[model samples]
Every structure is written in C-alpha cells, then in structure tokens.
Target: MNDFELLFDPIREHYRTTFSRIERLVNRRKNYSIDDAYINLSIVESKELSSKEENFHSDANYTTFEEIYGTKRPIEIEQLFNDNRERLLVLGRAGIGKTTFCQYIVCQWASGKLFQQFKCILWIRFRFLNDTRYPKKSNNEQYTLTEVVENECFSNKLTDDGLAVLQFILGEVRQAVSNSLPTILILLDGYDELSVCEHLQNLIDSLMKSPYQILTSRPYNTDDLKYDAQMEIIGFTNDNIEKYVNNFFTSNEPQKSKQLLTFLESKPSIYGIGHIPITLELICSTYGEENKQHAITSGTTITITTVYSKIIEWLCRRYLEKFCNCDKRHLNLKDRSEIIEDCSEILDVIGSIAFKAMEKSSLILDKTLVEKELRKVSPKRPSELRKKLLNIGVVKSLTAGDDSTNVEAAKDYYFIHLSFQEFFAARYLVNVLQNPKRKCYTKAINFIQYEKYNQRFLLVFTFTSGLLSGNDSLSCLETFWKAMTSEPLDLIGPRHIQLIIRCLEEAGSDHRIPQRSLWIEHISKWVECAANDTRDHKPLQTDSLAPN
Candidate 1:
C-alpha cells in the first residue's frame, strides 16, 4: 500500500465504526448512520457585522445574520471547507451542528469523496484531549501526532505489526511535512471545551502554519488565535427543517410524520425552534410518542418550555419502564402515581449533576464524581441508575480505552446536548425554589449573578419563569420580584435585567401582581441602577416592557 493509504485505511475504519453508530430516541430499536439522518445545512461567511454579539437580544436572538440584510447566499459545506484550504474556523452557537459538521468532514474524507488535495486527515476532539490530561511532561515530551492517532484511533486493535506500520507512517508524514507537501488535514473540534493547556495552544499555533487544518468552536472571540477564513454554521432553513422532519419520522411512522409537519405548521413559536437541528430532533421524538388522538383533540397551545418539559417527562417515563423490565430491577412501582414520584426523583438527581457541571463550566463528568453524587441521593446501585440514564439518552458515555480496562476507569459521561444540560439545570433551580429545604437558594442566586452562566441565562430564566407562572397556588409575581431584587441592583447585569423584563412580559397584563404600575416602578428602579452602573447598557425593548 502507498504511505497515504497505509495511514488512511485504519483511520477510515476507526471513524466509520465510531461515527455511523447513532441512536435516535429513547425507545427506538434501530440505529441510523450519521449520513442517513444528516440534514445538509448551509453556511455563510463570518462577517464582522454578522457576529453573535450583534444578535444577542432580550427575545432570545439566535439568528445567524443581521436584520438589515434580507438573505445572504449560502455556500455548500464542502465548498466552504475547500475554499479556506489550510486555515478555516467554524463558529456556531451550542447545538447548532458544529460537531456534526466536523463529523461530516471526517466521514467524507474517510470515504475518499472530498478533500482529495490532502493525503491524510487527523480528527482531534479537544473534549477528549482535555479530559485525558495530555502533556505528561512540561519539557519537549509533548505528544506527537502519531501518538495522538494511535491513542484515539487505533489504541484498541493495534498489534505489534500494526505499531510498526504506524511508526513507518509517522515517519512518512514527518517527511511529507518537511518536504512542504499538502499531506495532512487536521480537524480540531470543540476548542471551548478544553482547559487552558499551553501544549494545546502551541499545537494549535503549529497547525495554523500547517498545510491544511479546520477548527470548530461555539461563538466566542479571543485574541489568542487567528484564522485565514471563518464561517458560521447557520442552522436549517424552513425547507431543510421540513426535509429533516420527514427523514426523522419516515422510517418508523409515515402518517405521524405528516401529522407532525401539519402540527408544526400550525404553531409558529414551536416551529421556529425546529430550525435548530437538535431542538428539531427533540420535537420529533416527543411528538412521535405523544397520543396523537389526544393532541389533536386538545385545544392547548404548545410553547418551547412545554416542549422541553414534555421531552423530559417522556424520557423519564421511558427510563422507568425500561428499568422495571430489566433483570436488576430496583424501581418496581405499581401504578402511575408511584411512577410519577420515581420519575421526579430521576430528574432531580440527573438535574443536580447537570446543574453542578454547568456552574463549573464543564461538560464531561468523571465516573467517580458521578458515583459520589449519586450516593447521597440513591442508596440503590448508582451504576444501575447511571445505566438507566444512558439507556434513555439523557447522558452518554465517552469510552476511552478498550474493553480490558474497567469501564468506569476508561469512560466519562456528559449530557446528550448542552441544551438538555441547561434544561435540567433550570429544573434543579426550580426545584430549589419550590422546596426551601433543599437550602441551595443562595447558591442559585449566586449562579444567576455569575457571568459564566450568561450563555444559558435566558433559557434557565425562561424555564423557571414558566414553571412558576404555571402553578396557580404560587404567587409568581411576588416570588419573581423577590428572587430578582434580592441581589443589589448594581450587581445585576444587563442580561439579567432583560431576562426579568421578558418574564414579566410573558406574565401578561392580568397577572396577579396587585398593581402593574408598582411592579414596573420596581423594574424601572433596577433598570436605572443598571444604566448608571454600566456604560454599555441599552434600553429595554418596548415589547418586553408592555404589561401584556
């Protein structure tokens, strides 16, 4: 075999096995390929004017382009990658298909369908690298590209001959690099997930000068790095959303898929979230499992928070059923009432973990930490509980080593999506508000005040507001005003102020706030304080200020 083929063959086989195995929903029997369920999303040039900061608004602005432009033309994913050649950076919001785009590139390169200009492609995930604790020594003993490849791609199946072949291939790659040949394409995924490592920084610096490389990160600006070309992953268009929903439901239930399309067409608010692929999947899975007759017969309006709440409920129900049916059944509830309680417990435990992780700005949970946390909640087997979570797609395993090592030692876990993590974190906070004995109200208040949680600030606030507003016995207005005003006015940021205004807007004109003018007077005081404290404060939107 040629040196390129020698290096590419195993890498292709490795990723093909890893990427193709995808599970769609909680109770689904069949798995789909990455390409089968993939919706081809279009990308636009990352203009300075089109950055995320411009899009941040009180109403949860997640658009890709500015409002002045009607629509800029989009380029195909491959064209965007190929156009940039060596140094390309892909930026997107959380769950907007950045990771999936990286996977698609790797899959395409592995199949020999794209990037024919390069001899080898290296796929590196910073999440794993950061978790693995790389750079064992501070000196020049940094990991080589070959070591990374062997560890990530071929560590499980490498034989003595395979090791020798890898060494030879590494030598060939070094020779190609020194000869100034276009021989490598490095795919660096999830830069934001990594801890601050100087070695990683140096490696990124070297890759910037390499012949071919591409990097993906959630939308954030940093002075530490520069790129030749940058593109943002704009999510699905209306047509693409329709196509994705059709693909998602066609195999299992065609009629239900049609009904889902109809239902989404009727509800613009929920339909807007369908433009995001992850939220789109959650919608399909939740709607598919719903009793269609009841949904068709009921007259209730479905909001975004309701959609996520139903998803969580569905996941918990599916998990409980599966656990009861398993051989080591710990939860043997008799009726719906018992099951409901059990489901709440499950969500509480999982939500607590998710909340703690988000506070620390981390995603992956070490198995040991998971066990420690689970011990306080459930005396029953924590591993079994974790397995149930894995089965339901709440948390997924990130297995590192081969089957020889203990699974706990070789594996880490994280929520399936950052959105889900935020949802559960909000759930945890809501539970705290509902029950004071949990005694973490101070922590929750501090969490909301911190700037690190600003990315998910709107989501958590909205969910908490929805929960409070839905309960008749609870005085949502009183509770909300007290919770928001507890912190000093000067300490509150503009995002928090905007969030409060949005929540009051949702509460409507007739909400039981005693007097609308009084509540507005309090909010005006907070806004005035915010304005005086920060020079960058912008006026709150008129719509959000309206009582209705």
Candidate 2:
C-alpha cells in the first residue's frame, strides 16, 4: 500500500538474485548467478582537491598509475551514507570502479544490511538517461521526479497507479522534516557523464536540495557541484589486490593465483598499476595466456599499455580458437601472429565506433550506430563481425538485452569501461597513422596533436602516446609532446599541464621506454617558464603556468 514497499519490493525482487561473470579463461566466458567476487577497493574520503593549481602534477610523476586524490584513511563503502552524511558525492578516475561502488551500496541496501535509516534507496544511472531508448519527457518543461524514477531507475516500468503513488511519495519526501513518513535515499550515478540539459534538471535540483542523497561520478569539478561529503575510489591496496587475484582464480588453480601475486611482487610497477580494477582483471586473465608471463617478464619494461595491448591480442587468439577448433594456447608464434593480423578487421570496426562515441562525449552507442559504422568499413553486411565485436566482452552491452534471445536486438553497448573506449580509440588512431595509405591518416594525426587539451580526451591522448611509444612508433608521440608544450609564449595552462602529465605518465614504465624519466625532468623548465612572465598587464594566476 505504501510507496516504499511498492518500489522496494519490485527492485529487491528483480535484482536480489542478479548474476555475475566469472572470468575463468581468456578464450571462454561463462555467466552464472552468484554475488561474492567483488573486491572492495578503498573508497577514501577525498581530500579537498586543490583547484586547477595542478594537483595531479605530483601524482603524475609516478611511473605506475599510482593512487591519487584521496585521504590517507580509507572509508568503508557503507560509511558513506552513515552518520547523517546524506548529501554525498563519490568520485573516481576512469575505470576506477565508481559504478561498482554504487552498485555495492545498492546490493547492500537491497539485502537490508545498509542504509536502514531510509525506507528505500533509488539508484539512477545517468548513462541510461543519455541513451536514446530511454523516453525523453519534453524539451519545454522540466522532467518530473516521478517520471525519472519510473523511467530511469525502476527495474520494471511502473504502472499508471504506481506512478501516481511515486508522485505523491516524492512530494512528501521533499517536505518531511521527521522520519514519521517513509523516507527514501537517492543514489545518482555518473553525474560527470550527465547531459544536464536533458529536462532532468528538476530531478537533479530536487536531489540537490535533499539531505538524503549520494552522487557518484568520475572526478570532475567539485567546485561546480559541492556536496556535504565526498569520497574517491582510489582502487585496491596490495591486500585487496591479492584477494582479487585469489577470487579470480578457482580453488583448483590456487597456485596460479600465487604465481600472479609473485609475478606482481617482482614487478613493482605492474603491481602498482594493478591497483586499478580493470587492469588487475586484464593482468590476471592474460596471465593464463601461453608465454604471457615470459612476454611480460622478458620485456625490458611493461606498463598498463603492455597489459591492454596483450589482452586484445589475447582476445584475438581466443577468437581464432573458435574457428580453428583447436587450443589457441598451443599455436606457434608465427601462426598466432598471422591469425591476430587477420583479426585486425574486427579491431578497425570496433575502434571506429569507439571514436565516434568519444567525439560525441557519449559512453554508450546503440546497435544501429554500430552497424552504420561497420558498413562504412566493409562492403558486405557486417552482421557477424558486429556481433563478435560487441559480444566479445571488451565492448560490453549497456542495455543487458535478452542475451538468450537476440543480442542484436535494440541494445545499447559501451566499451567495458571508458578507459577501454579510450584504448580502442587510441589503437584505431594508431592503426590509421601506421597505414600512410589511409586517406584519414593526416587528419587523424592532426586531431591528436591539436585537440585543445580536451579534458574529455585526455585519456585518448595518453593512450595514443602510450600505443605509439609502446610499439616503437615514437615519431608521432614526440610530436604530440611538442604540441602540448607549444602553448604560445610557453604559457602552459592547467589543461596543458594535465595533458602533459597524463601522456608522460603513459610514457613511463611503459615496457618500451629505453630509459626511465625522473618525472620532474620538466620541473626546472616549468619554474623557468613561470618566472619568465611578470608583466602587470599579464598578471598570472597561481593555477596557470606563464612566461615572459
């Protein structure tokens, strides 16, 4: 009869028994219903991130993707909503498990183990709202909070009567001063990716005014959207990393887990980068590849780039196994390379889609777009390859359509993570550049160099640099470096600083760099630039690098 019961029952029933993917082998993927494998990464209270004064400058100096932007003390995920801390914002870098953190909170709440103070918790993924499939209310009026819950969050679309109940409940939720009535908490996921003009401002404004809400996003401008409290998912510590590796490997393969930890221990840089969840997954999964360890260990160096590239290569080998009906692991190097070379077609199509989505600042694309992009590359109907590109687990489905029925149905897909999209985009650009005969090669090269230090494309540039450097294609990346520091009059902005920092990060411990960078190799130069400019007409701000 009550609103909370009406909403919570449907949500709990639909999601309480959700399935998880247990990645056992690089070649095969199996899905089963269980919920124990999530490795709880450290979600620490974010220190008040300094303004554009280049806070990442120090964090960037490390060779590994070292943890940054959080307090020394880590907080339990549940602690986020505890102690009257309602208006909370959770931030993390790309692929740092921000959504997983939110989902964990959801799982906990649904199990009646957390946020007991509220009658129900509403989880909203802004990514879904950005999807074209999700019904858009209208352009003229603000979208109703009721419509948002019914359309965006609810597992099953609400009936007319149910929507009436929610509309009434929301009215009380906003006005209630005490817990005499049923109270609900809101979890806003992907705020950074939210397209604010989606007539959803009313919903956002309502949530902003409420004391019972949590917003999660990739770290962006805190100054734009302040919260009562903020937390950052800084990825796993060593102990948790060990636990994840243990969980990933089966009981029958315990020694394999031990071997991975041992390998990571020996390579501190690789281990440090493993703090990231996706990188850790790639590291563990690819570890099973034939000669993967030898390749990782034998290299003069290895970085996240090495891991990402190997995993894609690994996916190619696995794909070949299905066709050849043989163990790809047993294949010789020459044969494997030849098969992987053949698989470049799949990569080209996937990368084109990824690049288009990135240009639109979108994280998800529907099947129509995929087919359209595929058609441009291949003359035939790229139906089979399209399915492979999507279902392959790297570019994952956003709208988890009935996989048992039609994966090709009206489905929305996203790269496994934003970082994955960036990797594919970068890889695609490299492919284009490597092929001088391609008509777009010059345009592609120019785009990478002169993206105006696009904050959204920072990872793209970093990955591009890493790919070029990792593959001995440094000619392009060095030019990119020159372009980054080529602000007129050497007046480097924070954007420029971040671009340089991230690209340089990809440059370090990157398995292929012949020499290690001190990282501060630019500090002396930066200081010289700073002092070079002192004209009163051009008074410099602390947040910017200036010159005479």
Which candidate has the highest lDDT of all? 2
Each prediction's RMSD over C-alphas, in Å, is 5.8, 5.0
Overall local distance difference test of candidate 2: 0.65
Q: What are the per-residue Cα lDDT tens digits for candidate 1 across 346-403? A: 6677788887876666677766667766777766777666665576667877765443
- Cα-based lDDT for every prediction: 0.62, 0.65
Q: What's the residue-level lDDT of 397 in candidate 2?
A: 57
Candidate 2: 10-residue stretch with minimal lDDT? 539-548
* Per-model TM against the reference: 0.78, 0.83
Best by TM-score: 2
Q: Tens-digit lDDT track for model 2 on 1-548? A: 66658766877655465412333334345432234545667778755544333334322323344536233467886677667676887777766677776666777777887777777777777776653544455556556778667655566668788876677667745465344556778888887676544555566677667667888876555447767887767888778898888877778888888888998899877887888887887887777564665645556566777787778876777666665465654654544357557677788788888887877777777677887887787658676676678545577655532222354645667776677788888888877776667898777756765674555676777787777776656655544454444444225343454555566566765543322243344444544555564222232342232211
Candidate 2, which segments miss by more than 4 Å at Cα? 1-3, 19-35, 48-71, 135-143, 172-181, 196-210, 289-291, 323-330, 335-339, 397-410, 435-439, 472-475, 488-494, 509-520, 524-548
